[model samples]
Target: MIELNWEGVYPAVLTPFKENGDIDFEMFAKNTEAQIKAGVHGIIIAGSLGDAAVLEMDEKFELLTFTIKVVNGRVPVILNIAENTTKNAVNFAVKAKQLGADGLMLLPPMRYKADDREAVEYFKAVANATDLPILIYNNPVDYPVFVSLAMFEELQLCPTIKAVKESTRDLTNITRMKNRFRDRYKILAGVDTISLEALAVGADGWVFGLVDAFPKETVAMYNHVKNGEFAKALELYRWFMPLLELDIHPKLIQYIKLAATAEGISTPYLRAPRLPLVGEEAERINKVIADGIASRPKLD
Candidate 1:
């Protein structure tokens, strides 16, 4: 396995499913290939955007094994662990490492909202379980628990608890993390809408959903920003915002799948409880994707 470079665009890729509720490995390959070809640095599988909650543990490993083979060591493949218990999370983390995962994107405990101590301890347990580097999914806005800076202080003892997928949405937290931790944690912007802003304000990379749909444009914007081409990146970001906002919605899985379907890289099909979009919601989001695609800026 290669070293885990926690910087650059890592798509929290969706699990494309067939109508029969089985994994669509064909569509999955298409999307993952698109991302890597477009210059993304890493891939995160089975995230919230990947419909992680509904997936069986065996199903997730199936995705992981297939992704690792598809990726072919071209880039790091990080699996997301969202189990409801520490024991399960630890067990999954061990298996993920054994299965050739480059890293783990471990979320706080599911269902029950753990307090600071509990959350920190939970993270520590998983870190101790596997040698795989971890990216803590710190999305308090969506998840019930918030991994505060103080809690991170307690988590520092776990050397394997590496980068953070910063989804707090408060951009200042990026600065605070930098101030307190220095280079200890690589802060990747987890919110798609504010990704450019996060990068501008010192985020090391972006762990986003929209990249699954618009890989070229997403990678282009990241390059423009890193090259100090603010005018160019902002112009692209302004045009990309409407489609990007689709990642933050309650039905983000549905919305992103629709966007990817429009691009011909993914299907609109999803697992149970997450049906395809329809009616006005579908129409509105489709228009945003259509308009974005129609007006997409030329990338050199």
Candidate 2:
């Protein structure tokens, strides 16, 4: 049976590259350790922040295999298998299941701008190709395709469709889905800035890039909200709001990787077609991150 046994603070890990730009397995293992040490609930591999756009098929499988082993069969590892083609993505999902990944999270098909009907068909295509539960990723910014609420209902009827990452950043859509499908599929927050608000609107948890920076803070805030400690959660949310603002930028991978470096985790390295944050933008981000860290509240 297709089941979405996923929840809590799952950080989309950055694919660490060597100085020569190859996938650095060592650094990737270390990053997993960092998240685990911080009490993160789970780990996601090969997502947008992992530089999925630039990786080849071999690199992807390697990362998935490495992730499964590094997580040591403890946390559920959700693999982002978003390819240009649904068939290719499904193939990756099947492979991930073979490697014992917990679930699959897919992006909206980006190359073709299909109508809602065709888009729904694309999801079915992937669903049929794999037995693992699927989480439909909706980021209108990168994928920029909007799946209607009706389509969401359709996906719910899909045997393999189990969750929605709901990156639409649409409050109305989020609220409507929460009301309509409250007892059904999982409602997860895909954006960092509104993660807490998304939880307010009934998100189960968050999959955020900025969590790479202050994972302990995010974990604390998540548990606080989950445990009904809203006052404490909101205080941490306000303190971390500035970093969340930077998470939506196109250079999010770059910025979060920089934050990882700041914490002595990993380097700020992105592959081709995506450049590192530079100039005044880089300086401003550095200052904001440093000042925010210095002034972050103590929840102890």
Candidate 3:
């Protein structure tokens, strides 16, 4: 089993697709390589950002296998499990480990908003099913299921559950988790808008979205904070705010893909139920990327 440090920048990457909706492996590799080259500490594949709900199991496994080869042990590749059933989630976890995944980013059971007991049981079942270290994706704002402090206390019984992605959109929870758990679970900031604050307040790491487009800038912000260069980090964060806000929207995949396109690292193609951005929305998002690029900071 790979040791996951559960710290530093980890991008939940976009799944590049052709206009015909086919997975574009070439573009996928380019973006993944860019993240690795930019010094991101880890990579997450097929999460909410990666269009996991739309991808078939075979495609996810193929992505997992291909990413492991492309990453070549340069950084850990963690797969996101968003299944709606404990059985399916456990099955995927076991297979992910078998396929060489270094860790997992597990969401609460999908579609059905499980209550506290149901959610804890779901998480425990997955944790017991495999030895892969799990990062609980606690995004109640989007996922509709909140993993409360009480719930986490029960989840502590599963030693394989190692971390929590704090996406409740409340920065105070970072303090709450630290005060309560005291390092039992590594806390990573999942919301881009408050990431710097989360880090300043002592989040172990950030699982970011815009890093898929602006890898260097994202990693630089993280390094700046870690090095105690608050002024420089805040400078970069202010510039990044517009693009970072894109990650919180319902069509974040489209917005981030457009940003990645401007950087020449990705194309703006997406599978349906999700279409390419058009008209006013497209023009506005394009300008945000353009302006950000025109004024991008010089980092060491």
Candidate 1 to truth, TM:
0.99
TM-scores for all candidates: the values are: 0.99, 0.95, 0.99
Model 1 regions lying over 4 Å from their true place: none
Colliding residue pairs in candidate 3: none
Please give, for residues 56-164, the per-residue lDDT of candidate 1 as tens digits.
Answer: 9999999999999999999999999999999999999999989999999999999999988899889999999988999999999999888899988888889998999
User: Per lDDT, what order, best first?
Assistant: 3, 1, 2
Instruction: Candidate 1: give the clashing pairs.
Output: none
**Taking the tens digit of each residue's C-alpha lDDT, what string does model 2 give over 1-300?**
223465788898889887788888888888788788878877878898888888888888788888887888677788887777777766777788887878888887758877888888888888887778777888877786787788888877677788788788886777888788785777678899889998887787788787777778889999999899999999999999988887888788888888877877777777877777779998999988898889989875
lDDT against true structure, model 2:
0.81
Give model 2's TM-score versus the native structure. Answer: 0.95
Candidate models: Cα lDDT each: 0.93, 0.81, 0.94
Candidate 2 displacement at residue 65 in angstroms: 0.4
Per-residue CA lDDT of model 3 for 32-151, tens digit only, reads 999999999999999999999899999999999999999999999999999989999999999999999999999999999899999999999999999999999999899999999999
